[model samples]
Target: MSLQFIKRIFTSGVFLISANVMLSVTSAHAAVNIQQWQTSVGSEVYFVENHDLPILDISVNFPAGSARDTADKSGLASITRYLMTLGAAGMTDEVIANKFADIGAVLGGSFDTDRAALSLRTLSSERERLQALGLFANILQKPDFPESVLAREKARIISGLEESSTQPESISNKAFMSALYGKHPYSLDESGEIDTVAKIKKEDLQAFYQQFYSAKGAVIAIIGDLTREQAQQVAELVSVGLPTTPAPAPIASVPAKNQAKEQRIAHPASQSHILLGHTGIKRNDPDLFPLYVGNYILGGGGFVSRLTEEVREKRGLVYSVYSYFMPMAEAGPFQIGLQTKKDQAEAALALVHETLEKFLNNGVTEAELKAAKSNIIGGFPMRIDSNKKILDYLNVIGFYKLPLNYLDEYNKKVENVTAAQIKDAFNRRLKHDHFVTVIVGDPKAE
Candidate 1:
């Protein structure tokens, strides 16, 4: 059958099904309507059409993540992404800024270990959409890689790197990644090191672009104020006249962390920075919902988290303490981090370790489980309520090839996760013994 015929059948018909029967399932968990189609140029789009608002939030994603950077030239991919909008086609960064400002839209870009994305939020009207879309297209397909702007961006990045090297938190986090991943790409910093940033060139950027930004590796997720027909057009419109090569780069492999380390750095800051973690789960893992819910009790829930409660409110060790797992295409970090008065740092770190070990051993308390579930489920809708939020979710879905209804099932998955399930997942997955401990403010007293 033709591709056109498949799409026609995909969106229109209601086919009957028995409980055991499944036909090319989209998302079994989410009951919400999620429309998906591949554009003629091969950009895939996921849509949740809500016409109630006159705004559109669209996100385009690619596998151009930091992991793809050259091992010898770490941070190249990241600098490439950051420099994308500085100049594209014939437009300077100033001109690009003016273009978006003129249209009353926002163009945003971000990347992590495994994916890079550019997002646009605009009035869904025709004129605004055209302007916004034009900028996005230009950046994707025609980034000029102008030498002058590249120089300026490098200087700016180098300055930030210099500043960060002095920062207690930055120093501590960098140490933790080095400890966690060893020689793996996950251990590399996205912003790169001072020496690497200084050595980057425009041709290097262009070569990297040519190698990575191809149709085969690209996924476009468009939502708001577009029909199926228009979305198909958008795929073509956005990805047209691009690099013609098939995807050639290998997807990065993040090795499982086998051990952990501890280190300390001296700084003049009033508080000591601490980071403890090891390798984390992947982005599309089945265990994501369970881990996410479980993490809230660990530290992600702010004042309600055991970390914050033990370190901040209960004992006044630090002003703030938190934990999060990055979850990307590759396994990322599951980190518990905080800062405390230099004098209190050693005691706080010991308590945090004990607390984590306790949680890992016994799981969250019953009250903690209920509170985490209530907060996560209750606050879920606010995440996807606006077009911008929808686009953000769509970006992840599109990039990761997630089920079209990932958001639809989000609440249900969280709802169905049992406390026992959470505990089991933690014990099965989180290996606290291999933690990479980094303290960047003072040495623990001898």
Candidate 2:
């Protein structure tokens, strides 16, 4: 789904990895060695050589996502990345699509808050790999951002945006983010408003792409059946043509909002969608493991989480409820989201607040901590079982500048987190009085 260009880029296939092997290797973080180096073109490259299969996966990440968009040009980054594959070096989008298909290679991309990326997976054979990489290079460096294609895509996206605006969940999410982030860049909707997107000209996209998608601003994550030398070559081939400039400055921090803000919008929907939270930790925060484990205990653990237990099982307020902290380049959101019958909206909201307060004050019980650690540690192997998953972690590590041994240290880190650590981490980072809450739906008649 991150690859927004085409819905079906590759056939439905999972890169099979041995779950048992992964489970057994939990003690060793060096299960797969990650080689890191800078390319000739200034791109930071992270390579993991896996010859288990004749598959090659490479992801090129740029600090050019929605966060980089100006207040008025909210969707420009996403639009630019989407259009890159449409036309490059005068080849139309159809020609590019056909080229990949003919080679049995897949080209895809994703756009998010802190980054945009283009990814490819292809057979490791020289013929196929070269063909795919060649096309990828052109898209990365020589994107035409053709005027006609721009117009078409803009219209398509605008239509989708217009449709989404009518949906309650969409409305709720937008309102929630706007309230949470205030005027910070993170507040902008991932997709721009219809008016803003309509104003995004080819010139706008070109300017944004040129400044933000350069080699210095990128990270190349390569995983598969390739040698270190080949990975170096692959990294260079894709980035060498990019403008060699200094990396841009880090994004501004989310302005602190010490006051609790609540936005209520009436909708005809039968269920109320409620979301609440505040600015959370950054990717590299020292408390990352503690927060991760704590969140799993709080609400991220699904069926076993405190939220699910109190909100759903004890009171049956909602069918499903969850919470998570998204640690990005800067502090991302720590959010709890749920939907319940319109009549019970207020009760559900109160219960959520009460439970969070109690957990924040008392922290998790020893039994709860043990359960969370067990679940997290037991499930850790599945996270790195596949090359694609490993590639994703590598991309994040390179982009966020995480420690190279992060994967190896993951299980141990979770295991080492004590109940006091979780409680202390949450107490320090989370402020109950300063959170933003948004509810969308008509309240039931009392």
Best by TM-score: 2
Kindly give the number of clashing pairs for every candidate: 0, 1
- Model 2: residues >4 Å from true position, as ranges? 1-29, 444-446
Residue 187: error of model 1 in Å? 1.5
**Model 1 misplaced regions, further than 4 Å:** 1-32, 248-250
The digit string of per-residue lDDT tens for model 2 on 1-446 reads: 02321112222243232443211211123776877877655688888988999999999999998999988888999999999989997899999999999999999888899999999999998778877888888899899999999999999999999999989889989998899988899989988889999999989988888889889889999999998657766776788788666787899987766899988888888899999998998999999999999999999999999999999999999967999999999889999999999988899999999999999999999999999999988988899999999999999999999888888888888899999999999999999999898888856321
lDDT of 1 at 422: 84
lDDT of 1 by residue, 156-202 (tens): 88899999998877887788888888788777888888898889898
lDDT of each: 0.77, 0.87
Q: Once model 1 is optimally superposed onto the true structure by TM-score, how far is the C-alpha of residue 138 displaced, in angstroms?
A: 2.2
